[model samples]
Target: MWLNGLNLMDLLVKKLFSYPGRDFKSGRDTFAPFCKLDAKLNHPHSAYRTIHIGGTNGKGSVATKVAASLMREGHRVGLYTSPHIFDFRERIQINGQLISHEAVHRHLSHIFEEDTESLSFFSLLTAMAFLYFREERVDWAVIEVGLGGLYDATNVICPSACAITSIGWDHMEVLGNTLEEIARNKGAIAKSGVPFVAGPSAAPFFPQAIHVQRHNPYDLENQEIARAVLSTIGVHNPKGLKEKPPCRFEWRGDVLFDTAHNPEGFLRLLEALEYHFPGQKFYFAVAFSKGKDFQSCLDLIRPHAQGIFALRGDHEKLVKPEELNLPIEETLPEVRPLVVCGSFYIMNLKPKKGRETLGDWESDDGILSIQKRGE
Candidate 1:
């Protein structure tokens, strides 16, 4: 991976995940693990202004944008996110750069030496991030919720602001079914005092079949969220938002990589596509997590998609292309300008030639540079 120095941090990152398995039944499980790890950060210096972002989709994007904007303002920023496309450290960054493996190992070793057995993979990793941020004395940190908000360990953040960027059907097993239910699950970051910024919603596509307790934060639309958050941050510039967090955009000649992960998210992504490359046929990389209703999401995207080319994410719950068994070949002959959407996992581009990213999780993996016609 083109990393320099510090083998210790790398070892720490890998070792941190020593405990396998997740009891994702609810937010409760998520907290317990973190609590166990938190008990170990003896220095206990958890002081830093935070920007906590949560949502089904776009949270990572918004978090990235927020961190970038903060960095542009010349603040020392720490960004912690999850499910890296490749490297584990992709999850933690300081001032716009990924932490070195050596640094990760050195930091993680301290926790390992203190208490070896209790921390879950997520918890251990989260602890490392907190330690690094504290040690570096960052001006601010952007923490992304790994799953739903309420119980997510990252929720430990006490921040200048909070953000929930769009909500929709996802993680049905934990968050519950229906948009409102899911939205509420994500909205938990809307604590009483912090400024909360939410992204736009496409409307509750589902009925009020599911009931969440009062004070559901997902109910706030993006505009309302923007107004609320702007007030807190003292930002009056909509002009700055015109560029719109590149959200998810990719390009390789005819093939475009758009990691549009869920169903409802297609609206804004498609809107972005129309603006960027109108009338292009899309060949997509589609997959659902264990909790996602794969076929339902597939059906929702089928019309807009030229054909679905399935792939997995680092989390490994993604559906494989062979498992899809859809009529992809037939659709491809007619579909122009193929797009690989839904997951970054599909960069391999299939056996057909030219859609390969030569590297693996390590940066040195060779990417399939280009595709020749009829190769």
Candidate 2:
């Protein structure tokens, strides 16, 4: 093996997973290491304004919309999200472009060279994104919280604005067993005197934040938050913001790709499904990662599903098909309007091609087309 650029990048990514990161157990003290790394990196995150988004659901959508809107307005925007579906580079992008493989290798080399101790996978990635954005001289960065907000590695930035899309009980083990705890953790992303925008339910958690007025369409509420965040930075007209990120109710012919892993997310997904296709029942292909309330999510859609196709996801923590107590199918159904739901890992599942094949389902670049904001 010559360890070419591509090989080096893959090796660095593999080494990143070996660190004591999100996959392993650690205390709040784990966050302290990031501070040292940031200092050594010269606080690259401070070079540009940041918009922080955290919530149980809709945070990624809101982040993407905000980034897209900024990008369309001619600003060099960097978007950082988590749990990439296919590519590790998807987690960091500037103006909808994935970070180059060489950039990843170069940054990883620097981090390893300067490191006195090991950093978490997320911490290293977060540092790499901050460094890349700063080096790229991006005008703005939209960062999405990977897990709970309070102690998440991405929370180290002092954002120009903060938004919490919605609060729900999902990560009870780490984020507390109640909604209040989760809300507080998510709301902790709010900076002092920095304009904080939150969805109606999440408003109570951020006492000083402005609440988005509830709207009929669930995504409208997410857009409202993005608009509010833009307003704080004097960018009033967020043009071209209507596009939804990949896997948020995305449709390929009749099969829907949705990352609705929790109960509340499923509720919103069901609402969107109902709004678009009235009086239509769907055949569901669902999978979920560990720590998610898969059963409750399933319960929400079970009544409306014509048949349930349990899919085993690619993650190690994925809930097995047998655990779902639903019929496991090795292939996709011939039924119209098949829905692939739950974890982002569902994108990894291989669906058998039928008569009506959804066109280019896996080719999503994860960037939405530019459209007029509020369209």
Q: Each candidate's lDDT (Cα)?
A: 0.59, 0.80
- The lDDT, on a scale of 0 to 1, for candidate 2 is 0.80
Clashing pairs in 2: 240-371, 240-373
Cα lDDT of model 2 by residue, 1-375, tens digit: 587777788888788777754733453666677788888889999999999999888888889889988888889999999877667778898987888878898889888877636467788899999999999999999999988887788888999888898888788888888899888777788888888888877877776788888764677878788888888888799964576666777666567778888898899888887877788899999888877888789889988999888886557878888888987875565666789888887765545765544443223554423223242
Q: Model 2, which residues run further than 4 Å from truth?
A: 1-3, 20-27, 116-118, 354-375
TM-score of each: 0.76, 0.92
Q: Summing lDDT over every window of 10 consecutive residues in candidate 1, give the lowest-scoring window.
A: 366-375
Candidate 1 TM-score over all chains jointly: 0.76
In candidate 1, what are the lDDT values of residues 1-375, reduced to their tens digit? 656445544455556655654447645855865676676575333668777877776666556656656666667988887766555677778865677656676777777776546445666677788888888889888788888877777766667888766677777788877777777777777776666555555224212211112112221232344334444676544221211122145454455555566675555566656655577556665555554556656776666676665553344655654666754341112234666666544443432344442223233332211111110
